[model samples]
Target: MKNTYKVNNPATGEFISEIEMNTKEEINLALKKGHNAFRKWSQVNAHERSDLLKKWMDNIQAHKAEIAELMTRENGKPIKESLGEVDYASSYIAWYAEEAKRTYGRTIPSHNESKRIVVTKQPVGLVAAITPWNFPAAMMTRKAAPALAAGCTFIVKPAEDTPLTTIRLIELAHEVGIPVDAIQYVIGEGKEIGEIFTNSEFVRKITFTGSTPVGKTLLKNSSDTIKHVTMELGGHAPLIIAEDADLDFAVSQTIASKFRNAGQTCVCANRILVHENVMDEFANKLTTEVTKLKVGNGLEEGVDIGPIINEKGYTKIIAQVNDAISKGAEVLVGNEYNANHQINTYFVYPTVLKNVQLDMKITQEETFGPVAPLISFKELEEAIEIANSTPYGLAAYFFTNNYKTGIFLHERLNFGIVGWNDGAPSAAHVPFGGMKESGLGREGGTEGIEPYLETKYLSIGDL
Candidate 1:
């Protein structure tokens, strides 16, 4: 009486294959194995652990094309983006491998002459890493790399829609000396796997990347066991354009950031705030850029945008756009679709909306599509207010020529990360997370490995 789910190619809406759900007993077994493995894995030499991670990274790089193809086939992201994700995932492993060598502790000065205080870090024990489908390969690996480097075993439950890439990566991990129990894959319902993570005493940490609602539920569940958790959830990033900034630069960067992965990214600019003096000019430029994009099957060359993940996503995006238009928002480009196009049901025409109001659904929610909603602001204060209006504070961007303006906005923006005149500010070596409801904790950079570790203090006194 177990449930099962079918996978689909979002572009063609073709049925792929079905995967059966893992039962409660099976999940418990995986957790037990992980707990047992952690006992031995935690004792491995740090340098030797780093060498093993390097091998895994090298193996992944060797099959980069294969990994990218599986990701695009399942997730409907452009092949180019898939390839980039694979490379980025591998880079995380490499970075964490080096970082493993430097998980250093410290000695503290003591007031008493005969006292010594020292602190060290140890693995947080078995982890349950739940990743979303958006960046199939990167999200899983980004969490897995640090978990393994910190000597913690884990069970990766990738989204049901996109499990192939992560499954293959786990297979590679085994080939590169990672023990089978040290890295396990469970492809099934989020509720089932999440329940296992929450109820099980073996799981010491939960690293999740998904919606804010789901993250909140996981947080509540983990509280039962008082488990450590890191979450990177939804975002409603705002891109502000100043009157004196270069119009072309702002337009191009916004287009690239907002439309990447068809605007499915968590850090995409959901609201665009432009100075009233240059609002008209910026809208026209953005319209021109949106028109130039090519939307089609991800595997096809020159296809700039891909289809929505499923019918639900397609319906939601269309409704949001329609609601905005009905509220008197002007559409400079792409409110219409070509019904004659055979794959039209799965495709959402990339849209650009101007004269957007704060009350509009498109402005209030994370559009999660290739839709651009533009709003006008007369002063820096107004721009800051609009940008911080959302409960979510994942990321924000602004273009300004004045040093004082840049400094002022940077200080006032209520976001975890800021992009100054640039849209994509994330990197493997830089910490990535959000503030407020966007979710808790951080991933990547020097702080990336910290979540997997727990600090221990030792004090010595004269006999």
Candidate 2:
């Protein structure tokens, strides 16, 4: 509806810049250009494509500081975290550059006497992505790098709240000799642009990262064209603490997992499942650490927590906190919602809730804010049951010193990723996705590029 997208610093609610929204006509033209580019681009040798991607990766590192600052301003993440994200984003490019050369094909022995069968991978054609604002830079490259490396042209519609980071990354790609039309972006109302992307016959595949409801809409829209789709949807991750776990190590890892990006990440610990035996100690240590975190503008020095993305996010977080409190959850730290605690309209206090019930909204829904709800469990089986209670099976974490317990949890967690005695488990080299409603396809690792490619079976008769 709006003709311009106004970018702002979410931390201070300051205006940054305004970008013109792309119209349906313009989007269609870009789609045609992307389709035309894909014809020649897909024919290029994998090694050449790899070289260009490596150049792109180098450019990202060279301008890391500038890009990191831009990301922080738009996404409201701490500057330190933004810098880490920049590195994480670039790693995808670097990895896919090398992985481009390894799209290996295999030969199968034919059952027929004189026939040979071979299977080969090829680019899936024009790919369209819709990325969210949480990890702006990283999410984009995670999809783009692999698509480009696989020789598919990409066009993305980034989240309206955080388009600047995506725009800057695409500029870097162009600077490194990447074809403008081969990798492009569109900024506008998501519904309109997304509809165009899904309806267009030229777009052969669609990759999306956002809420489950939206992912379902896209999935339904793309069905008419029967396009290949990759959905990295919502996650309600649970971090379990076993009775025999190292208390100090568990506390530190929980801090790293729960508080990073002010607890806005999809894989961030949503529920803290602590063993009842050590609940008081874990709760006390976690509360002390949370109190020490400084909440302010992300650009300011020594600030650990930043503002929530917008007023809606702030409201949702507050509502969840209230629901938990009313339902008998004890506040271990940060339940104050007064002007004295909040630096701005969108700044939420880093909160930790103990005795959190499974029925509370905070435990059931994905709270994308600076809040951690702790739920106590009596046994390993009960913990597993509680963790698997949600429909989302994206990522689960547990800290256990026992070999048997660790192995059992790992096998029974039913998530795409399981962190054992580790809080931050994601890396560019491993497959990242979720099970069930969490997501539909993998990103990163060798599997990351597979969604961008299609396999062809060749049978040579009388060979």
Candidate 3:
């Protein structure tokens, strides 16, 4: 109901700017414009679309510094991380620009001598996306690039906490000779805007990256229209450390995976499973590395950990840590929250817990903060079992020197992505999504554009 949406620097709690909220009438008009634009945009040759996307990608790269600063301010990520995200985000557009030319269809052999069958992929029409705040720029480009490359008009409602980055990206698109109506962004209450997207007949496809519960609601809402939907939902990623794993390598990889974005990522190592043979060494080394991390304003030089998104995130992280402590998890390092810290109230110290039981809240829930809980397992099978216990199956990582063991874990892990010895597995060229309750569909690689395309079969008689 509010007319203006306030943007703030989560790291420093500084007022940034206010964005005008789109009214329902304006949103409806935009939808009409998007639909109309889709009719023409979808008719354009793939090569032209690819050129436009490449131009947009170049523009984003040219303004990388400005966008990264805005992203760090609004999204509460370190400036260096924000810059990396801009590169990651632009990579999608670059990839899709080339992939646009490769939307090849198939010609199926017909049983009947007089008939020929052909299959073609076409744009699914107007697409609506609701992206998360964690990786604001990357999430948008990951979805939008493929959709746009597939010749679908796009409209997005970015997370309220971080809309500026999305808005700026859209602006870059428009400046690069891309039509405004062909790609647009709306700012407002998520529920209200999302309902309009789900309920609208003109929106042929809906893509979202958020929580499982919200993805379910959107699935239900879009059922009436039977809209094509792609949901990249929640993840409770597991990182397993086998007995034969290189201790130093595993520790470094864990730090890269767990503490990136202050552990606010969907694929952050939520449950760390370590073999009993190396549990103490792993825990001690992990604790030492965590303690060495610099937590402060994201804009500050050499600051590795930044403030949590807001009070809700801050409270949730505290609750999860406290619950683990109450259930007999021993704090190896950083159980103390300095309430009197002058930097920011939402700042959570990087935490590590040893002797973490499987029943603890930290293991069951996605700890979206910089907290690592070490759970010891005696055997490889036990570690596998513990890692696969959760309902979420987005990503799983394991470190092992044995080739056979690595192959075994890779095949057995019930996740969309499996990292044999690596921590970060996501990229512009790999399919990324989750299984089970983690949500549906894939993004990136050759599979990324599939969701935005509709397959049509044609039969020619008397050929």
Candidate 4:
């Protein structure tokens, strides 16, 4: 049966769109198409692929407003954040477009002058790029843009909750003459879609962004056939505020990092560790700012944030909040859902929590909500220890004016990406990914495409 999946409006728990699921035969057909396309597509010159990426960026720009709105509709992020995600995603196209031509090959001198050695990078054939719902379009493009830039044919399966925007992106690419199945999209539940991608012999690479447990599962599956896998998994990020940190800046940034997208981000600051010297001021300022954030429907103007994605995410967030309270955590600003308060009928309150313990359910696990736990530390050593305590080593943020402390923390933190004396926008030109459970493989700049490609060595016997 060709079952359909519906995208639900989180605030109202109403269906937004119904997407058709590809059947087993259809999945096989897509794999066949990808296999056929990869041979021809990967054989094309790098410059040609770069040119198409440029065109794709332009196409995305042309439909920026519509695409961003659809993202907001599906994921319930503020329109501004959605638009920012689109702009950021466009930059990925531009980045990989330039990277495609700049770093492709190498030549190593042999022991004898008569012999020469050459090493060149080649695409990994068909890649199945699976993306998560939060920052849906950007995640897909981050995975697909690099694979395509590396000359690989892609079958993109975006999260079921937010596939419309990305499906349209594939359609846009087709409009720009990238070919019909060169970048196909499968819109269905993870189980069905992933089975096809992992089990198919023709699909050689799997590029994914999602939870760590799921990443582990996929990694195991890919290993069964020895297929290449690039996974961007979950993170429980920690933000530390040193004793000398600017309390105002620390508070504002903490709220922003923790609650952005209603706290659905995998890299969101899950723990806030503040030195005891600044705890009172930090907590006060943070709660004040969190209190002022205008949480409403994404389509409305001036709304700083929006609802959690789907009723399941919404319920999960509420459950975490209630559990936090029952376990001795106190609400600083928001603790209840204002269900009667949706404009497009999709909205949630920005939440803040204090007096949270390290063993609390919300503290240990990812609540993926607007909840921010205000934790206190007495010493720099303790702060660093607490930050690295979590198994996830994705991204960690720290605020400190002391240069020595900043340098020490930067070197000591276990996270893959570290933000110095501030929150997690390290840079766009730099690489992004984690070290441990967070994920494997980079996602930006020159390093992004390295995961989607392989290098081959050739030697000339008698030059």
lDDT (C-alpha, whole model) for all candidates: 0.90, 0.92, 0.92, 0.83
Sorted by TM-score (best first), the order is 3, 2, 1, 4
TM-score of each: 0.97, 0.98, 0.98, 0.96
Model 3, residue pairs in steric clash = none
RMSD of each predicted structure: 1.7, 1.7, 1.5, 2.0
Scored against the true structure, residue 109 in model 2 reaches a CA lDDT of 82
Tens digits of per-residue lDDT, candidate 1, 48-96, equal 8899999999999999999988888889888998998999999999999
lDDT of 4 at 323: 83
**Cα-based lDDT at residue 431, candidate 1:** 91
State the displacement of the C-alpha of residue 35, model 3, in Å, after optimal TM-score superposition: 0.6
- Candidate 4: tens digits of C-alpha lDDT, residues 111-186: 9989999998898899997888888888888878888899899998888778888988898999998977789987
Cand. 2 TM to true fold: 0.98
Summed backbone clashes in each candidate are 0, 0, 0, 0
> Which parts of model 4 have CA positions greater than 4 angstroms off?
13-15, 339-348, 426-428
Off by over 4 Å in 3: 338-344
Instruction: Score candidate 1 by TM-score against the native.
Output: 0.97
Error of 3 at 154 (Å): 0.2
- Lowest lDDT sum, 10 consecutive residues, model 1, at 336-345
